[model samples]
Structures are given as structure tokens and as C-alpha cells.
Target: MPRRCTRNRRLVLVVLFVAALFVPALANAEPAVWVVKGPHATVYLFGTIHALQKDDPWRSPKIDAAIQQSQTLWLEIPNVDDSASMQPLIMQLGMDQAHPLSTKLTPDQLAKLTRAANSVGLPGGEAMFESFKPWLAALTLSIAPLMQAGYDPSTGVEMELKPEFVKANKPVKGFETAEQQMRYFADMPEKTQIDFLSSELDDFDSAIEKFKQMLAAWSAGDVDALDKLNNADFRDKYPELFQILVVKRNQKFTTQIEDLLKGDSVSFVAIGAGHLVGKDGVPAMLEKQGYKVTRE
Candidate 1:
């Protein structure tokens, strides 16, 4: 199965709470960073990978410097780690016991899902995931492999960075609230959600491998490679999802960054690496708006 399905989820969902946490900076790592300057404000844009193994190093001195220079940090959400607040929302929007997975998926898909569940050490049994809405099920399946592969969300960039911001008395803002982020998936048409689940099922076995490829590209600061490897196939296979999850969100974020630039404060904006690359990425959008955007 192609890794496109998994790639799509990793790019966006990882930024939400789907993927796990952070590690020290690797001397050789240079994930892409962009400097966007407005007349009065300067914003540093850095792409982030949400889940990473303990051995992985992504923070570079440039990023460190940017963090020091900025008065505020901006992420996809301000409270990504607040599971207590998220659980109720998930229960309300992500469960559908009355409908059940058996009713929505084909026999073949159910079988694949079963195998995927077992591989990830999830409870065995056909009904194990029956109560999950298709989108939630897909996210569950996608996240398990990453965790099994030793990816920790507790160590992800935001997890590591949020604390420093708090200690410094720097405000950490978000492009959206966690509820809005969740609704992006929960509000999808059932057919689209099912298709997302099916694709995830097809790509289950390659989840870790695909993520490694993406991580490599990110670490190398190869935006072109990252774009082709992560965004292209996903955009082609699921255009609507790509638009909703990536493009539209980037557009909004770009606008927000632009507005931030009009102020005198320096801000560092970190988001999913996938949103920092490609034509519709936040950096590109800002460049088109006549801001001085320089790759660092």
C-alpha cells in the first residue's frame, strides 16, 4: 500500500494531539526555518514534527536563537496536551456505537483493521473499535504504529517548547482551538471519513517507514523533498482533505502571521512541517503577500 494515506494524517493530525513528544537538538539537523519580516514586526516560521523517537534531534542553534529573540510562540493550538478537556469532546463527536464499524466498512476492510489493531497491541476482538466514528478510528490506528515505533508525543516540539515559553512569561498563542481542530475531522462527511479510514488501513504496515522518510526530509531542511514525499501524494489522493487540513489552514495562519507582523513584537511560529512547505504553505502565502520571507 502507498504511504500517502498515512502521510496525509501525519502532516495535519500530528500537530493536533495524535502524535507524541521531543528530544535534544541534533548537531546535523536543520529542519527548514523561514524569517518573515513586516515593517514593524519580524516572525520566525519553523516547521515541526509532532512525534519523534528519543534519539532524534531536530532543534538547531538558529531555532534556539529565534526562540530567544521572540517575545511569543505560536503553535497550531495553545493547549495540545490538555487531554482532560479533549476527552469529553472526543466522546461526544468521535463515538457512534449505534452505527458501528461493522456497518460502515466492508468485510475486507474490517479484516485489515483487525490485523492493524493486533499489530499495534490494541485489544483483540472485532468489536474493539466498533464504537469509534470512522475519522476517530482512522486516527487511532494511525497513532498506534507511531507510538509502537517509539515516537513519544510527550517529547514532541510543542511539549518541549511550551514550558520554556511559560517560564519566560512569553505568551503562547494558537491558530485555532483544540475543539475547532477536532471538528475538522468530526465534521467531515461520513463517506470521506470512511475513505480516510480505508486508506489508513491500506497503509497500516508502512506507517513507521513513511514517518521515518518524512523525518529524514525534515531534518535535512529539504523542503522540496518534503513537499514531494509528504504533500504531493496526499494532495492528489485526497484533494478535499488536503484543502481542508492543509491549504485553508495555512491561508488562515498566513493571515494571522501577517497581522502579527504589523505589530512591533517578535514571534516564533511553529507548525507541522507539511504546512511550511508546498505552494500553498504559510511561508509561500506570506511571500506572495509581499513580506520579506527568507529561508534560514
Candidate 2:
């Protein structure tokens, strides 16, 4: 249905989708893949880039054909409403009361967090967000720099695709309700949140650079590049987290995709491009299930 990433890291999803791989560790980039077997419910996997330079090349012709052929547009979460939905959870997720923020982290880490926060124009870290899940905060922090870099969520592809989908009266469906999506945060263990926050806050600039490199790979449909950018180390360190946000969801979405291809629904399935490439990615998963997947 849609693509998701570790935690609520929508920005991370954005990064992975566009910034896929490199030739050294990664093989190469390729174009969009398709599985339009039946005339009824075939799905055209159109990977999406939510943020881009206004001049970034929209180079995939197969993707454009899928978009034109599909009857409706779908997305991960419906809108930014999830941010509002996530506020309470974020507040509750603060440094536990048993170990107040003062004791939870060293002054240096706090300072770093604040400095990172300020770099993106976010209010001071002291601002109440205790209930926030760490992953959610990481996501916010991850996207902050991008905003400063001139990326606007408002200009994201799904945002741009909405008017057309609505005008065509195409049924717009949300894969998960806002609350269900918020629960992804609610259910996370606090330690995971803190660890993620620590890692992200500690490496904000590197993450940005990684994002840049990843975008380069994704532009070429390079699955190999995507895999390297996917970072085996990160996946190993947070296996369950990665499973929940990426692999597990990819598995479920694959089922939905299968059903779509068996019907009359001409679907232009645009997800975070990351889900379509890489090992155990959607294309591979579909292939394993005996479906014929091919470059468009």
C-alpha cells in the first residue's frame, strides 16, 4: 500500500527512497520494476521521492506510465495530522520521571541535542515533549535539517499527487489510521527511542551526507546502491525496529499488491522507493512468491 521506515522517520524513508546506493559496496541503480500480469488488479510500483531539488530529474519513464495508467493514488500516512497525533505520545515519552532529563543524559549530550535542535529552528530541547517516542523525535530532528536545506514537505510527491487523485474521485485510502500509526510509537520500548535519539542526534550531519549519497543512488534505480545506503550495520543494530517499519510492512504490502494485480484495478502504487529495491525488498519478495517482476 505504502512505504514506511524505521520508527516514525518519514524523513528516513524519504532519504532511503531517493538515496539508494554506491558502486563500491552497492552494485548499480536500475529503473522502476513492474508486475502487471492480469488486466484487473495489476500494481505498478512507482517509487516516490517526497522531497527533491525543484530541478531534480524525474527520469523514470516507466514510473510516468504507471502514474498515467493508475486510477488512484495512495500514500503511507494521509497527511501531517500524524504529527499532531504523535504529540501526546511524544510528551509521555520524555526522559522517564524516575530519571529526569537532568539525570537521563549528560550536560554535553543535552547541549548537543539543543544545538542540533537549534540548527533546524526547532524550539529549545527543553520544550515539553516528554511523552514523545524517541524515534518520533529522531524523525523530527532528521527532517529539521532538510527543511533548513530548503526541502518542504508541502512540495512532496504525495502532496503534489493529491489534487489529481481527488479530482478523478479516486478513492484515497490510508493504510493505517492516525492512531494506529501513532501506536507504532506508543508500543516502542523507551530504550530504543533513547538509543535512536542518541545515535541520530550524535550523527545528524553524517545522516545528511548519507542522505545526499543515497539520493544519488536512488536516482538511477540502483538497488545495489540502496542496499548499501540501507546500511547493514544499522539494520543489524535495530533488527526488530527495521522489521517493524520496513520488512514486516513490506511483507504485508506485498499481499495487498498481489491482490491488486489479480483484479481490474489499474493501480499506480507509489511507495518509498526503498521498499522496491534492495535484498528482501518488495521486488524480491514478490519474486519469491512466484510473481514475475520486471523493469518497466
Candidate 3:
């Protein structure tokens, strides 16, 4: 196994924790935002790209107004920016030295993985990946290309929005903890994790192009296209991942929004754009519960 030096380990943390989860978008973006109106509560459901290039204008007047009106902010997880708190947890959950990837992947697959890693600038090459669990490897590989293409995770939507709320002393909450979110991948069966990694590696060559398409669709606020581009293939290819990562989480998010409607405060909820489109998305589920969900 390759040595887990400080630089490479920090790279893993950045890729897995920050850059890889959400898609990215471009400037002058309309992107999607839904206003769920209840008798006493108003919750803004805004779709967010986790990483963005410098000067990507993802905000609009409507979005700015909503932020001002809201008293609380909701994100997938609030602790994402707290790397010191999250690093040890990531190490515990994402590493599996006892089960080297060499034993799980065939020699041919290993060779391809090495190539894919190098192509994207992942550190340590084939030997270093030995301790990485399949899910971690897949995430690291998927985002490396985008990072190389100039996406900056530090400027992501969550990163940008969090500070304003903190300075204002407004409460920011999460649908789940960071540990719970990571467990969605870490708890998968070994075979399932390998399959997930293999699928990502198989598509390594076109990941950037796919991301660009997503960027265009999301920037244009094309929910239908987003559904097709982001959800369809993954749902068909890895139903378990689709169920666990998307469907169930959307359900949980919708439920949380519904609970918020039972109260009397305004809240801004920003999550990955993929979770807000499609029929199984949070917006659709909220509509089914008799809330007036208006796309703004």
C-alpha cells in the first residue's frame, strides 16, 4: 500500500468531503428554487452545486431576497466546513486497510484504475489506493478531473452561504449528521461498493463532459434535463445507491420540510441540485403532501 502522507490524505478529505457530492454550474445561472408556502411557514428549497469555478454567478435577486427573508438555513449537513472535526471521522469510516483493493479488483481492473487515478491527478497511484475503500476511491476519482478542470470546492454554494448566516447569528441546521451521510456509502456491502467504484471508473473518461452537461442544465434551471442527466442512468445502473443516496434521502428531506411547515418561521434549504429534480425529488414529494410548491 502507498504511504498515507499528509498531502495525499488531505487530498482524499477534500475530494470525498467537499468536492464530490454535488454537481457544479456556471455564471448567470437561474438554477432552480422552489417556495413551499404553508399557513405560517415559508421554506425556500434551493438547488446547489457543491463546487464551482471562480466568479460563477449562481445567485440572483430572488435568491438574495430569500436569504434576507429567511431566519434559518438548512443544508445537507452543517459540519461540512469543519474539517478538523470531520477528518478523523472520515479516516475511521472511509479507510479499510484490512481489505486491500488489490484483493477485490482484478489485475486488468487495477491497471485501468491506476490510469484513471493518474489521469485525474489522484496522489499515490495504484499502491496508495490499496487502503481506500471502494466508495472512497470512486468519489476521489470522480472529482479529481473536475478539480483539475478548475472547479474550486472552497467557493461552492454551501461554502459561500454559510458565512453570512454565521455572521448574522442565524441558526443553520442539517437534515442529517456528517457521519450519517458518509455511512450511506461506507455501510454498503463490499460487493456493492466495488460495483459502484467500477461503474465510476468505467465512465472516467467522460466524467467532465457529463459534468458540463449537468452544469448547463442546472444553470438554465432545466429540471427535466437534470432529471435525465443526473438521475436516470444511476437509477438504472445502481438501484441500491439510487435508493439509499437519492430516494430515501429525498424522503427524509421532504419530511423535514413538512415538519417545518408545522411551525412559524422562514427557512432556506439548500441541497444538491440532483435531489430537487425528478419525480422522486424533494419538491415532488412535498407537492404530494398538499403543499403549494412554486418554482421561483
Candidate 4:
């Protein structure tokens, strides 16, 4: 693939992750929450963002009530507040001592990557990213600009709601471990990783603007717009990644949710919004399985 195409592809992936991290604004429509009714139980599924601005308006009375009513809270991962536990795992999966990342890129790609790193005020420029795997490098670069703009991962919806659930004495659980999630990137084919890095470098300049548009669509609860902006390009251009990161995960989560529905407890499931829309989304998949899924 041309580097430009690769860049656009990787940019879409980052946008999906970042946009999924925070709840959208829901300006003209109801926020994207769903009720899945089974014979024995009910589960509330709320789309979430990983990080967000402090003042972003994402909470509504309906969402608040759902949180309060639920006996169990399920997040993508648990203990998001405990970043310390992830440090060793990140190093194990992300660092490359035998070969620096610079060896894998062309001179021009390396230059672009360096410029991107500097642009985001990441210390050490090219040197800083030298030991990182391409996927990790791209992810770091992708999140840096957003962080610089005051979007905090700590202030993301998941973190904000976690304490509330804890205070209420509700049990919290995770779909995947942080280690498992890291391995998804670490185990990618080298070619794919290179493409990911090149794509991030190519798309770095426009990422902030694209993210803003995505956030707007999310806030508006415009599922069609979110699907088009977040999934369309990725599904078409990077089917493998789309399958691995979104489709397959959604399927696995569906099975877990089915198990949850077999019980009588009311559960609140907060996951990335990206997993809850489009043809292959969780809502559609659940509906196909004969579960009555209604938007709230």
C-alpha cells in the first residue's frame, strides 16, 4: 500500500479507540444506551470514551439511573485506575532491544515519525520512539496530541463511573486483562505494524481535526455518522484489524453477555461505542440472537 493509504488506515484505528473512550454529546438525540432484555435478566449497554475533557457533557438522568439500578458493572478492563500494574506488561510487549524501530522504517518515514513525536512535545523525538514497537509508537503518538489538548485518560467516562460503582458497593468486572489487550498489538504481523506506524506518521497533522469531527458525531448520538466516520474506512481498508479489534471482540463479548443474561442480575456494561453500532455491532448481533435490544 502507498504510505498515504497506510497512514489513513492507521489514523482511523486511533480515532476509533480515542472516540470510543469518551461518551459523545448527544446534542439532538438520546445518548447511545441500549437495553438488552432476556427472559431472566436485563443488561444496560452504554458506549464510552477512554479519555475526555473535564467539562464534556456526557451524563444524563437515564444513564445515571441505569448506573444506580445495576447490581454489576462490566468494563472492558478493570482497575483502570491502577496504571502501575500495566507498566511492566507494556515494556515487555512494546520495547525492542535487539532492533530499534528506526531500522524498520525508511529514512523519510523515520523523519516524519520524528517530526510527529516532536510536534506532540514527546521528549527525545526519534530517540524516544527508537525502542518501541511500531504499534506502541503509533498509539503513543496518537494519544499525545489529544492529551496535549487537555483530554485526560483519567477523566474518561470509565474512570469517572468506576468510583461511583465502587462507592455504591457494586461489583466491577472486565472482559479482558490489560495483558491480553496489549498482546493484540504485540502479536500483529510485522508488515501490519510497519503500516500502522507509517499511517500514524502520515495522518498525524490532521488527526486532531478528524477526532473533533468524530467527537461531534458521538456527542450527537448520530450512529450513522459514527459508523461512517469510524468504521467505514477501517472495515474497507484494514479488514484484519477491524476483525481482530472490533468484530471478534464484539463476538466474544456477546457470548459473555449471553451468559450474563442467563442470570437474574441487572448488569450495566460500558464499552467503547465503536463496538455497539453498524451491521456487526453488539446491538445488531444481540438482536440477531433473539434478544430484544432497544435504544434508551
User: Best candidate per TM-score, number?
Assistant: 3
lDDT of each: 0.78, 0.59, 0.82, 0.78
What is candidate 3's local distance difference test score? 0.82
Better model by lDDT, 1 or 3? 3
The TM-score measured for candidate 4 stands at 0.90
lDDT per residue as tens, model 2, 1-296: 24322234443332222222211112233455565566446777766666654444454456566767778666655553234444344345432445444345567867777788666665445443343445556666666676667665545556556666778788666444444544554467767666766766787877668777776676666667777676565577777767766687678778877877777877777666766777758888988888888777
RMSD values for the candidates in order, in angstroms, are: 5.7, 6.7, 2.4, 6.4
What's each prediction's TM-score? 0.91, 0.78, 0.94, 0.90
Q: Best to worst by TM-score, what's the order?
A: 3, 1, 4, 2
Worst 10 residues of 4 by lDDT: 7-16
Candidate 3 residue spans exceeding 4 A from truth: 1-21
- Kindly state the number of residue pairs that clash in model 4: 9
By TM-score, the better pick of 3 and 4 is 3
Can you tell me which runs of candidate 2 are displaced by over 4 Å?
Answer: 1-33, 53-60, 79-103, 106-108, 125-131
Q: In candidate 3, residue 15 scores what lDDT?
A: 44
Give the Cα error of residue 11 in candidate 3, in Å. 4.7
